[model samples]
Target: MKLLSVNLGTARPVPFTDHPDGVTGIDKRPADGPVRVAAPGPKGTGGSGLAGDTVCDLRHHGGADQAVYAFAREDLDAWERELGRPLANGCFGENLTTDGLDVSGALIGERWRVGSEVVLEVTSGRIPCRTFQGHLGEPGWVKRFTRKGVTGAYLRVIAPGAVQAGDPIEIVHRPGHGVTAATQFRAVTTERELLPGLLAAGDALHPEALAAARKHVARYGG
Candidate 1:
């Protein structure tokens, strides 16, 4: 797999965003040169791992578990066909726009070495939210996206370094568990019965998702 483009965004006003200041960083553009990738902080306090990227919402977005969002160009193409419109790289607010990568099919604990230094772990699937639905201005987008279950993936920075466009992506680790990004999305969103199965992924899961899965097991005995 390859990193098609490295994208970054700044804070600006977005008309349909829920944030008082408006949603900005969602509109990422491709950038040249090496971009530093590091853990911002804790789950709720951190922004993008990429140095120049901004995370507008702390409570709902950004953190170690979601330091970087990745979406495949192939997935965007699929969405384009349904929406009948062009979707640009970084348009989904992802830091890395990847090519030849089955992001949704990635195992929850999978690790990727980007370029030569940066290592990122797959944590969870991106959850559709109001901000995302609003940004696209597509009616019933939340329901549509949820039904499609191709929510891309959230990643935690395991090794900090520089990443740039056209960098090669190397799979460093793959968990034996069968919990893929799409599987996790289904477990959390529609198939609550599958939550307990996610435990097989162990520490590879995002902390919050791990907690939620445990809670589901406790409450529902899944």
Candidate 2:
């Protein structure tokens, strides 16, 4: 697989966000040059991992575990066909738009070496929120997206470096667990019974999902 485009966003005013600043970085565009990739510290404090990209709602985004977000270009094409509109490379607020990658189905904790430098690990799936729903302006978008369960993968930068469009992606590691970004999304959002099974992924799973699974097993007996 290869990187179709490396996208970055600038903070802009939005009417739908709960942030005190009322700004968001949901509108991303393909960058013209190579972008620096690094861990952005932790959640609620750090911002986007890609240099020059904005992450307005730090409380909910931009952290070491969620350093980068990736979505498949094919998925965007599918959405374009379904929505009957042109969706650009970074329309979904993703940093890396990939070609020929099964982003949604990628196993949790899978590691990908991008451009022979940066290494990123699959952490979790993007959970649709009010900001996303408002950004799209589609009625019942959150519910629709959850039901569709094609939520893209959030990545944690393992080895920082420069990444650009046309960079080749190599799958370097797979945890061999059956839990994928799509499967985790479904377990957390729709089917609670599957939460306990997500433990198979162990710490490679997102902290929030890991906690949910533990709670499910503790409360319901897995």
TM-score of each: 0.96, 0.98
* lDDT by residue for model 1 (1-222), tens: 999999999887877777777765777888889899999888667888889998888888888889999999999999999899999988888889999999999999899999999999999999988778877889999999999999899999999999999999999999888999999999989988889999999988988779989998899886
Q: What is the lDDT of residue 135 in candidate 1?
A: 77
In model 1, the Cα lDDT at residue 145 comes to 95
Task: Tell me each candidate's RMSD, in Å, in order.
Answer: 1.1, 0.7
Per-residue C-alpha lDDT of model 2 across residues 1-222, encoded as one tens digit per residue: 999999999989999999899999999999998999999998989999999999999888998888899999999999999988898899899999999999999999999999979999998899999998898888998998899999999999899999999999999998867999999999999998899889999998889899999999999999
Local distance difference test, candidate 1? 0.90
Candidate 2 accuracy as TM-score: 0.98
Each prediction's whole-model lDDT (CA):
0.90, 0.93
Candidate 2: segments with Cα more than 4 A from true spot: none
